[model samples]
Target: MTDAVSYPEPLAHPEKRGIELIESSERHGRARDLFPVWAAPNVSVLNFTVGATLILLGMELWQAFLVIIAGSLPWILTGIVATSGPAAGTSGSVITRAIYGIRGNRVVVAFFGWFISAVFLALNWLASSFMGAELLAQIGFTDPVLVPVLVTIIVAAITVLVAVFGHSLILRSYPVVASVLLAIFLLVTAFVLPHVQWGYTAPAPLEGLPLWSAMTIGFAILASSPLSYSNSPDLARYLPTSTKPSHIIAATALGGALPAIFFTSVGALLATGIDSAAMDLGIESALLALLPAWLGPIFVVGVIINTIALNGMTTYTASMAFQSIGVPIRRIPSAVVVGAIGTALTIYLVMSTSLLDAVNLMLQLLVLISGPTMTVFATDVILRRNRYSGDDLFDEQPGSRFWYSGGWHVPGLLAIGLGAAVASLFLTSSVWTGPIAAAMGFLDLSVPVSMVVTAGVYIALTRLAAKRRPTAIPSIEGAPA
Candidate 1:
């Protein structure tokens, strides 16, 4: 018989919330509060560039916007996961053990966690470092290499400090960040829109890539929206348990998708208004040259703020993920460890000549890995109807329901590997494309294909696992008493 869990009121202390199942009483926020957290981070230069790149590659404004809207559709799935947080009362990674077993779940969380945080963190660092170097040059520091190194060190230090303060503070700051960024971008958008040729098309000579290929790139960019689901639970875990799952789902989905659409559409408009060659100089340079003198520096400041905010959240989520890996450290220490390692990587990439190529490679790699992993997790959650024991997530004793197969769920492992393998066969990116993708005229079908394949394989394997071990008690919530 299971002992009843005693959920005291949610603690207000910053240190009290790390890596533990938040008790019922501890949950404090409402569903509507999620909007800023999901919206704020995406209102950045990185997303703008996602739109600009498609136009640079040969897509028309309408085409680019359509592709972006389509790619963002996956966030619907992410919002669904957000709802699981309050009910489960823990980090989503912890709740995953019900599907993959305690030990098996680690593999998924560690890979997805490290990659998602590291890639985005590096991108954020790169953007801020470049701008910082440019600002330094204006003020008389001219060494090409030294300036970037200094900027990276400074930006990474600030980001680490923000992350170390932990969750509640992070939540409080998102709305402020969102408001400032929204105001800045709205002004820029107002200035740029009148100059935009509403019906503009890609120029002849096609910019060296066909329109279809550009659409594929655009799709990959939008897919990053859904891939963000990996960290949404970190925010959602604080909401009141009575917050309806439907409300959680709606808030996260709408909040995230709206900003992404707005910014990306602005990028599409800006892409058509400028000399296409400006695309080669990068989004920041192009925008700086086009905007009036006063507006230019303000744009840079906005990007810097966005960079720090995005990286700060990445660092925080990564620390929680580390703790979920069974590490004995507290949340702040884990944040420090991941922050240092991520900072080192950011500095290296910022200082390197191959920075753009490296960033593209990292994004493609995420597209490859995230699809199957997300599919398996989503399938598990849906099949179980999101029911989870708040107590079981942390229990590791021998008889714990989550300890299946000595902590490894073979079927789950097999499904993920097989699904990712099949998806890689059709992936297209700057770094690599699968043979099948190349054969199919280099169309990127990685995300959809991986989801379908993983879903099918996981469903079949899970059913088989059940039949093969008829007497084995299932670990899912609401299993037979």
Candidate 2:
């Protein structure tokens, strides 16, 4: 019946097909506004919640005002401010296009993004759920465990809804929420100021524990530095490239820093009044106590709002990772699925493990994955000897750096995995064999060490891999636009 069997040109190369679809994704909401995407700030509440662990850290290791100020301040400022979300709407692909080559190797970017996201989804769910539920109990909510689950469900729903509407809404909405958060932080810190024991703990121990032990207990738990992490760039993709990147960075930094300062004050205040603050009063309850009776509902609303703000990011990033992986699920569908997955896992965490461990693990991985992903982009765009700039947005040549070896990059993959693995063994292995000694200690190096390893390995591997393989593939039309 067929005069001659022949397949369409695009059908011959599935990689090329993959490229075309992803390129179309770059074009969503072309007519939408850019300000919303670039300006919508992420306000992380971990500044306060993280105090639960840091309170414990202060008691166990060192609570040096200087060190806490140093470690926590920049993280608070840079994390929230330096970070922005990915693109959405008309200009969404524009930022990504700028980061990757114009030849459109987003697939390569997506691969790494997926790995990073899978881990982050697990962290966000567990951290927010445990923190939310515990906070409810602090306010005397009945059956604290059950209360966290319900709150988690509500939170996941709100984030999914916001994300479904798109980043424009997220951007416009965040500023309002952030304003309220600021007032709350300021008021609470002022209330607690009278209690700071400058006379008693004035020169808080700059060196309390052994170096290794301090690293194990202190930095491991302290890594959630909400200032640096909360306002990730997943939503910022909507800003017009014409919008200066530096401006976006500065705004987020300022927004995120405020929370860090407030949270650190709360932690130090809690420590200062150690004689008075009950074990149960720990962190969340302490803040609740600082508020007037009239403000209880407002405080609860604050917790709920913060949960929504960050979890929205979790769901959004999780969906992008899934979409990039070519899941049959659409963005909305993927958001719901990932949200449920995070919530369910969090429920398991609340029931079984120490919530603090879960918090540490998540923060560690966040630092680890983020470093490599950021480095790859900066290197690919800024450092590559061969440039692929411009509206080369639709270009998706096969065997390109992104499409090489069937779209699996062993170099980046190996670097990331190795970094995570090595950090786990050296930094956290409970059975300490020897110390080379006391380098990182028997603690988690998810952030500091991972950054070191990721940067070192990615560059080294890329250089080695580049020598044998040609930098660019043949500029053929058979695959990708």
Q: Using lDDT as the measure, which candidate wins?
A: 1
User: Which ten residues in a row are the worst by lDDT in model 2?
Assistant: 11-20
Give me the displacement of residue 380 in model 1, in angstroms.
1.6
Q: What lDDT tens digits, residue by residue, belong to model 2 across residues 1-481?
A: 1122111213222111111222222332221332222222233345444544554444422453443454444333332222222222212222244333333325534554544444545455554565566556656886857876776677767767765554445555666766776676556567666765655433334243343354444454454343224224454444443444455555554454445555654665555654543534434555556567667556656656666666665556556544443456556676677677766766776676544455555554455445444444433333342133223333345544455455455665666577656555544422331242245434444455655676577667666655555343211111111
- Alpha-carbon shift of residue 229 in model 2 (angstroms): 5.2
How high is the CA lDDT of each candidate model? 0.74, 0.47
Q: In model 1, what is the error at residue 291, expressed in angstroms? A: 2.0
Please provide, for model 1 over 344-443, each residue's C-alpha lDDT reduced to its tens digit, 9 standing for 90 to 100. 7877887674334555566666876777777777777676667667777788766576777888777677777888898888788867789988887787
Segments in model 2 whose C-alpha atoms lie over 4 Å from true places: 1-45, 58-65, 68-141, 200-212, 215-217, 220-233, 274-277, 280-282, 353-357, 365-381, 384-397, 429-446, 466-481
Q: How many residue pairs clash in each candidate?
A: 3, 22
lDDT of 2: 0.47
At residue 450, candidate 1 shows an lDDT of 81
User: Among these predicted structures, which one has the highest TM-score?
Assistant: 1
